[model samples]
Target: MDIFEDKVILVTGANRGIGRALVKALLNHGVRKIYATCRDLNTMPSLDDDRITVLSLDITNDEQITTVAVLAQDTEILINNAGVINAGNILEGDLEGMDNDMSVNYFGTIKMMRAFAPILKKNNPSKIINIVSIAAYSPLPSIAGYAASKAALFSATQSVRIELAKEGIAVYAINPGAIDTDMNKGSDWDMPDPESTAVKILEYVADGKFDIVPDEMGQGMYNAWREDPAKLSKIFSDLYYGEISE
Candidate 1:
């Protein structure tokens, strides 16, 4: 099914970064409506169109998640794109940083999925796309907390996918390697453009791909996992530690 054609989609964290690009791509695909939610709707780049609805939403807040879930019950596509990155190791990092990362990346995603599961069930032939990170598959030592949170989300996505399959609803996990966004401004590695990543992701979703790894790096990680899981972990660890032994 061409999921974006005349469908209603709700995208979280749509004010900027990849989320905003996703909204624009969906609009180009001729989606019927897009509820773009962010912490500050006013900051959202202007998309002068009647089809787009700007909403103020913080996914970490339970009340806000519930409210938006109710308001956008007719949605056929739910994109959980909201997340935060805490730059520190799990053991040595501030406890608050770990909590914040989990709150937005893992728990926030779970909360949103839980709140919208019923609506998705009611609206059959729906899809829920979770924007997980490459960190989910391979953890980095520096960003252990962030990676752990995404790993949790990745596991949750699998469980939900199996449980929702019978209801004709598909759950997708989108793992894109280092996209050029504000989230990774300080990183030295080359990253793809957010707009391009958004386009590829939407295309994959429309084609009903379950695990959409959009970039070459992501594909390489998947290949490594299939060939040797331990080797892949070592490669990631080496890269994180600047070992230059890939």
Candidate 2:
């Protein structure tokens, strides 16, 4: 339905990385207004566009989310792009880090979705795009906790998609592979730049794709997941344990 052009969109974690790239892409796509939010307004890059409004937001904070929902009542698209990855394994890692992963990545995103669902309904013909990860399909041993959180979000996306169907709020889950962002700075994966990844994401969103695997690596993982999840899991495990090399 050409959701981008002239649409009122709200993007979380817009200070940098994918969220920042998405804001730039949305500007190029001719969106009417964009509510770009991040945990710290000071860190937000200069986006000198009349159509954009910068706001402070930490998705984990209920009060901040409520304020944003109230302020951006006209939003037609809510992009849950805020997330964190603590470098830790499920078994020997700090339990607190795992908890933090679930808190912001899973719980935080869910809260934002719930808060904005009503606003989206009022706007009608709206969309909610959750920036999930291919890790949702198979656990990466290094950041197993983050992978688990994404997995939870992926499952929630499926459930909410069905729930929001009758209400005309199209819910989409974007499963991106490693992208060139600070979040993946420690990784050696040949990741695509965030700008290209963001462009691909919106293209799929406008195309009405429910579950979007946005990059080549993520697409391969998605294909393997569809074919056989257990096999994919083993491959990830082997890679982590140095049984295979990319």
Candidate 3:
């Protein structure tokens, strides 16, 4: 499906990073409208375009999701891009950190699907995009809880894809590698700019590329995964510069 024209899209975590970049990308494509949502409306960066409507939405909150669903009833595309990373590991990760990661990354996104999938189905031929990560394929030992949450989200994405297919709603999962965003601040590895990354993702999606892993690292890991899933563990382990002790 071509997403570049005459579509109403809703993006979560639109205040900054990839989500923010996507808003601009969609605008450039001449999409009809965009419901750009963030936790705090005031914190949302102003997009000069009148087609963009900034809304306050914290996906973890069911009431807010329901409210936004009603408000954006005409939405044809939903971009689940909100995410969080907690600094912890399975061996000694903080309980709160794990819970926060799970609540935001896994449950939050799934809940968003639950709330919007019906609305999208009503629109017919609508689409859903989940911004996942390469970490979902293999655990990153340092951010164990975050990786685990993304892994769960990856599974959920597949299941949702199957279930939503019959309803004419396309479900696409974006497994981005290390994106240069505030989320990855101080990372030792060089990361791709989120703006250019968004451009690549949108262009590929327009051509019907379902599972988009835009960056070099993401594509490399995906190629390795196609050959052998076991290689993924080693690929990430080496990137971390530490052997997986667990």
Candidate 4:
């Protein structure tokens, strides 16, 4: 069962970053159709493919979610790749930024999953890929709110994976680290491009991986977190304090 081959897939946040890259990757993988969505349709690039359908979707908006669910009723794979990162921490950081991050990264993804769950059930043997972050495991103090939101999403993904296990719906959590996109342009880490990241993530999905750390840095960080969560937290703390190069 090759998931990407001839599958009707829907990807959120398809305007740029991992979402945009995933669209191109899916096309190369020979998908039958793709519903690429962004909050603002104008931001979506003109992808010259008959199989592609561009739609306006703000996951935080319930109306839009319902509309997309109806429009993409045949979707076999739902990719919750849309997210936002606001620069805020627990102490003396932008409160509004934190709220925005929670709204977009945590609540928005959850709403998408809820809306698509029934549709995925109708299609059976489907997949739901949530683009979480490596920061989910360890909160980087610099992006504390973003990390916290992803952490919430990570927990929710696990719960959904369990509940949907017997229903033929595979829920996957993709925790990626430092992909070179507009989102991470402020950082100086030598990051892998989103194209490579997307390829790796899709490969993992095809391999029946449930929880994937889709890059070298993410793999290392995942290993560290698995070995000792406290140690990973300390490393992130050091990075925040300039005691270590992030």
lDDT of each: 0.88, 0.92, 0.90, 0.93
**Clash count, predicted structure 1:** 0
What is the per-residue lDDT of model 3 for residues 108-214, given as tens digits with 9 covering 90 to 100? 99999999888999998889999999889888788889999999999999999999889999888899998999989987777899999999889878888788899
> Which tens-of-lDDT digit does each residue in 1-246 have in candidate 4?
266888999999999999999999999988999999999998999999999999999999999999999999999999999999887669988999999999999999999989999999999989999999999999998889999999999999999999999999999999998899999987788899999999999999999898999999988888999999998898897788893352
Write model 1 residue lDDT over 1-246, tens digit each, in one string.
Answer: 355789999999998889999988888887899999998767888989899988888989999988898789898889999999987876787778889999999999999999998998898788899999888887887788898999999999999999999997899999888888999897777788889999899888768788889988778887787798887798787787783343
lDDT of 1: 0.88
> Which of the numbered candidates is closest to the native, going by highest lDDT?
4
Q: All predictions: root-mean-square deviation over Cα? A: 2.1, 1.8, 2.2, 1.7
Pick by lDDT: 1 or 3, better one: 3
Query: Residue 16 of candidate 3: its Cα lDDT?
Result: 94
Top-TM-score structure, candidate number? 4
**Which has the higher lDDT value, candidate number 1 or candidate number 2?**
2
Clashing pairs for model 3 are none
lDDT, candidate 3, equals 0.90
Predicted structure 4, TM vs. truth: 0.97
Q: Summing lDDT over every window of 10 consecutive residues in candidate 3, give the lowest-scoring window.
A: 237-246
Question: Model 4, poorest ten-residue lDDT window?
Answer: 237-246
Candidates 2 and 4 compared: the better one by TM-score is 4
